[model samples]
Target: MLIRSSTPEALRQNNSLSVLSALRRQGALAHTDLCAQTGLASATVSAITAILERDGVIERLEQKPAGGRGRPRVLFQPKRDCGYLAAVRISSDQVQYSLVDYAGRLIDRFEEPRLGGDGATQAFGQSFLAALARLAERSRLARDQVLAISISSKGIVDPGAARLVWSPVFGGAALDFSALLGAVWPARVLLANESLLVAQAIAAQREGQGHIPAIAALSLGHSIGLGLARRDRHGEWEVSAPNFGHMQHVAGGSLCRCGSQGCVEAYAGFYAVLRTAFQVPPQTIPAKFVPIAEIDKIAAQARAGHRMAIYAFRQAGQSLGAGLARMMSLFGSMPVAVTGPGLRFFGLMQEGLLEAFAETHEGRLNGVPLILPMTGEDELVFEGHVTRALAEMDVMLATGQGGGAP
Candidate 1:
């Protein structure tokens, strides 16, 4: 429900954004193609492209060979050397850093062990700063060459400020990344939930396919994550990562890592499955980390008809289905994309999931066919980061906020 102004400058920026968006989606394009795709006049396209090329944000390609008669056509694409982006993906065990070009090519990447203790936040900040410095040094690029820094984590994040509002690792201690990096780094900082980026990648991939009003993505692991991407009436993309895993599913039922009772994550998270199959007391605080190998063993046991393991997976599915059904009740049913390391056991959980889903009021009333598509969580998360970061950079370019380096 947000309204945007359409002033002269705003319209020009919108046109430029449209051109950049089209190029990003379709790769290199001729001026005529840009005009057609963006609905901008030929003159406007020429003007925008000229400015972008002059600013070093985009580059003109050599003229293509003509088929028969007329003059050769010239193409344009984003200039790879014009800007760079640094991506930091923070997880419970490790933090991954990647350097990417304006064209979304990965230049360099590395992972570092995550530090944890009484002063975990302070330790992490120092480590993060060092990591960025190392990345820039390795890439042989000055700090100012990095136009943007995108950070993703498994927690509630402030959409505007690149801040971790609350994280399972930090609990009540929030980290404001915008202020942290703004003090020394001139690059723009963007923060997002890991799974939200997964949803963003999926939505961007499936753009203009059909009348898909909305899509929901679920991530399953030591913690649960959910991302929703909706196409509004004006066809603008609206995305969110509601602390869905923390949503109360059953009152006073089981303990959750967030120190709550019967959150969806209590039953659906990997640790929850371990607790259930091992007959651990529900009141016992769940383990902070659950290795993938442990879950794989459980999946193996369930495949071999182990009653406890099968029961544990079914319970997790029931919790997930119920949570998703509740979401459908509020947002209406749409296709659901399931990702994360936990999907390896989807076969064991499918029956319970569908059965529980069918029992919900939204599922029964809407009768919308459910499609649970599997995807690579890591790849999607990184792609989503690049997509979002580049989009923001495009807006900056359009608004004249970005200028060529001396």
Candidate 2:
């Protein structure tokens, strides 16, 4: 085992973590590259790599041709089978779980229907655990081999306390999943809001790219969520004010499921956009149509250039842009990444949103750029959870904990 009680083991763990992190961030790094990236001696890098390779945590790929003179250098990549982590994303309508490798690739995914309303607490908890157990069993990963488990939800999570402080979807009461899951699986667990994890993932991808200070992310789904990043004096990425969705946007737009009116989510959320697009009578709208099928149909029709569909999406974009303008003014404008289902309508709302944003801004703040829409899978939140869990593991290893056996 890589873990030991002696000082030698601590040093080994630290060195291994540095090498692993280098490979993860730079992808197939050479020995020299690892040394330079990690500020470790060449000999230390070799020793760590040797131990990691012996443990099946990393492997050397084919050597690349020499650039000019010297011998060709061998590159290393993370071994996918070494271990895996589980990423769970819980929302109002469903719970999604994935088995992700050390390289952050999701190898398998599982989702279960969510129990809605106040009665969903116990039901969702049981179903979530069962789904996780099934996924782990099917994937052949043991409980101890799960380096860590990170959960992302549509609410504010107090990680230190291991409780969800408040979730519009779960009501205001704090939901303690740590205590709940601890009884089932013994593993190092971290919990955070889906939006915050999404932001962390974005920041991790953009790290050292000179775009850290100006990067921001917006999650558009059943509810709108935002994540902002800024660089500290020490030149480290820091997340700020992750839960910024509850701010009221429309004074009299519509009543939210949380019993509030005029919030941005009330107008631009997945359900809100669907309700607006379908023109369904409020009383007649079915439960299933709110978050899934209706929004999907609208996306498909908008893609087909249906007039009403396009108009409906444009309206959603306008509402989103309006709320975003307020956020930009308060947070100082930055390069915004609009993600999630909302990006499906980026084409329909791109011009309108930009126009609305432009109409509101007086002048650029700190030369921060305008919102940059990113279109990708809804599984991004799960991906974020994986990234965060792996990063935390990397930190633990770097600090001499090896991979905790919990």
Q: Estimated TM-score per prediction?
A: 0.95, 0.78
Deviation (Å) of 199 in candidate 2: 2.8
Note the residue pairs that clash in candidate 2: 250-262
What is the lDDT for 114 in model 1? 86
lDDT of 2 by residue, 355-383 (tens): 66666753333332466667663655665
lDDT of 1 by residue, 1-406 (tens): 2115688888777877888888988879998899899888999999999888888888988675766557767899999988889999998888999999988999999999988662279889988999999999998998878888999998899887778988877776888898889987888999999989988888988886877888888998889999999987898678899999999889998899998999999998999999999999988999888888999999999999999999999999888888889988888888889888888877777777778888888778876346676768899999999999988878777777755542
Superposed model 1: Cα runs more than 4 Å off: 1-3, 66-71
lDDT of each: 0.86, 0.70
**Clashes found in each candidate (C-alpha, N, C closer than 3 A):** 0, 1
* Candidate 2 accuracy as lDDT: 0.70
Indicate the TM-score of model 1: 0.95
